[model samples]
Target: MSKISTDPTRRALNGPTMGTRWTALFHVDPAIDTDPVRAALQAAVDEVDAQMSTWKPDSDLMRLNAAPVGVWQTVPMPLLEVLVLGRDIGLASGGAFDMELGDAVAAWGFGSDTADPVQIRAAMGRHRNTAALEIDVAGARVRKTADVALDLNGIAKGYGVDRLADTLVALDLPAGLVGIDGEMRAMGLRPDAAPWSVAVEAPDPARRSPHSVLALHNAAVATSGDYRHWIDVQGCRLSHTMDPARRAPLVAPPASVTVIARTCAEADAWATALMVLGAEAGATLARQIGLDALFLLRDPTMGFRSKAVGRLFCDQCPEAAAQHAQ
Candidate 1:
């Protein structure tokens, strides 16, 4: 907690979306219409779910998935943006964060149904290449050169966070802070002119604890970890973030990966992508792409250790990271 807190009349709102809840911490004046604000916030995220959710059979993403190969299907602007960014990161990460994992995701039981052994057996990794997905940004259209199903599971929640932030901004509360599940975006300072404090969740599956706290201003963060959203297969635990090559949860994955960027969607996708890249390769790619990332890994003998490589983590959380390392 900061020395200063937001206003006494500051309203808090939250509701369900994408199997998780969205939150807003904002201060509104008597002149503001809160009912409309709430509706808008809810609508923004619902629109995203309608467009991107793999669970929804009629979602815009599923429709695109059902489209014939090589056809340039028209997509909404938001979906277009996420698809473009997903592919860009996919290419940059060498398919480590591949967006074309819809089949694999559904096969792993992360989608609308239980895992199918048959689909799991058929799931295969994509050949990394930027040329595989063709996007007409100006026209808001997309085409796939290969038979890859587009899945935005890695990035949609973060985009939802960004949407919440966007709704707040639209209501003229440019300084409000928002969280969707654990993904967060700080629009600006609080009403008291204090930076919003966000907690970085510990990688321990058995406990809900803050590994560290972040002072966020005009930034967004998303964390992808093996701790949550996992299922036990045979005897071992597996994260929902599957490995394309093996058609299973990422093998020997990092405990967690946190990424900060200007947009929550970018943070979301990059976090998943970097997790897939593992600590070494992911860190290198983050540095190359000028992204801020903190990687938490288990040291064989030393236990939990964090390796942070990015301008944001290095600058804002230097002291916190140091204390955690100790």
Candidate 2:
């Protein structure tokens, strides 16, 4: 059912989780209490975190990761969906966007643990696992062929956003936008039928500004960037984004990669993949996959430059696009 608005009053519900927050903006009847609805939305994302979080030791994903190799582990449907999607995207990106990098991420201090060279070396063992992950979607089960670790941190937030959208839609929210972190999904037009305006943040972490504003409707957008999250390694700054081949944070990761997809999960995964692939190769992959993406590149001579491909992204803000062009 399309959630078209029947009333004009707008209501927003939000709560904190995943070190961030999940929010829903929608049209509601004046009498609707929205307390129950808010709780349901929070529960939705909480379930996702319980099923997929790498930070939580008791999470379903951690349990599965701790299980013996080749042993089939039953998991929730949402987890199964994420594993399958992550596997597909990893394969499509030629292992550029690996989901099984828990040890490396932890070793690099991106996770809770401090950086350890031994763990990093062990995690980056050659001829052992370039990538080894398997899933049985039909059975809602998973089995690893190698000793590598699993982490869905890259895509879980976007999946959380999708879950928020699903909850609002299930609750019959009449036309609104939902988001978790930077991943966002717009459900429908406003009361005036004007599309919801979503700003694409400029990739500069030092100075935040809008690169462009998108008129989003029933679509999701996600960005992966190197600017915001980083750590200094011996005077060299490294992003939280891990490169599987290097077994370390991207040395000079792209400034940002934004993707608009039918679902937030895809957008999240692809944005990360593109950031790993850089501007040129990422643009090629985005084109081949027929996805709408914008790659923000950092040039030593030119500063920040961006390229957009597949589907219209800046149809709402020509002025911002023009400014970016210059």
Candidate 3:
């Protein structure tokens, strides 16, 4: 009988750049070289940062913002796709997730600069431009009747995670988990034949404990919250998530919203939309749209509380089902 060759599997790779860390893990032959895979994954991440980063004035997003209205300015394909998706989601969620909030985000100090009172007022008074904008993806262009600035901060990271995972798979490593910041995508099962486990961080600024853990087989997870990026003005805390209608921070803070979906982009947008909608309406809408989501709210007296929506959490949380029954 011929002896069989058995090879150990390589599982994890990590690199730091783009203001955050990029992590990749796969169950692949350990004997197979992984340096090329690492390099390709990092390159894909760099491409995403270059195209969508608001911190970079020369980024494609900024170029699109500065471009003249009603003109078909050619832009990189990735940016064009993200913008197109933003438009679709904005309309789908009734403008809850607006990409035309660049001015608002920057004015609120969510961008690369400090908060400016003048910009904040202007951003608040500015009319929403997303409702009037149109995108032509096939033509690789966009047009706006009114002055509108685009920001992909909400969806870009998740999209980047998806891009990274796709890059790994294209390089013949189909079983891997790719993550940037907190947004992540799991391509296949781990080497132990178990689903990839990810922790959903608690929204408590004072606590680093994870509130919930998810077992992802082949899916993407994205979380949006008010805890990380915020401003304090006269003892009032303000989050980066702007209400498009008011063009300011959300009046009521939602501790956090975590979404698990088929694609990172969808999960990202859904998380933002839920944040904007607040807990009650957001939960209702999420169920109506059949989204898998977890909404965490901060209590004035109690530290934190949570609610789960959709089928994904049905098996995980019996309380969610019990609450639904009542």
Looking at candidate 1, what is the lDDT of residue 226?
A: 93
Runs with alpha carbons beyond 4 Å of true place in candidate 2 = 1-7, 126-131, 313-326
Lowest lDDT block of 10, candidate 2: 317-326
Tell me how candidate 3 scores on lDDT. Answer: 0.82
Q: Report the lDDT tens digits of candidate 1 across residue range 232-315.
A: 889988888977556567988999999888889989998998898899998888888887898989878866888888756773
lDDT of each: 0.83, 0.83, 0.82
- Please report how far candidate 3 places residue 148 from its true position, in Å: 1.4
- Per-candidate clashes come to 0, 0, 0
List TM-score per model, in order.
Answer: 0.91, 0.92, 0.92
lDDT per residue (tens digit) for residues 40-135 in model 2: 999999999999888899999899889999888999999999988998898999988898788889988888788888887877774437547677
TM-score of 2: 0.92
lDDT tens readout by residue for model 3, 236-303: 99888989899999977688898888889889998999999988888888888888888888877876
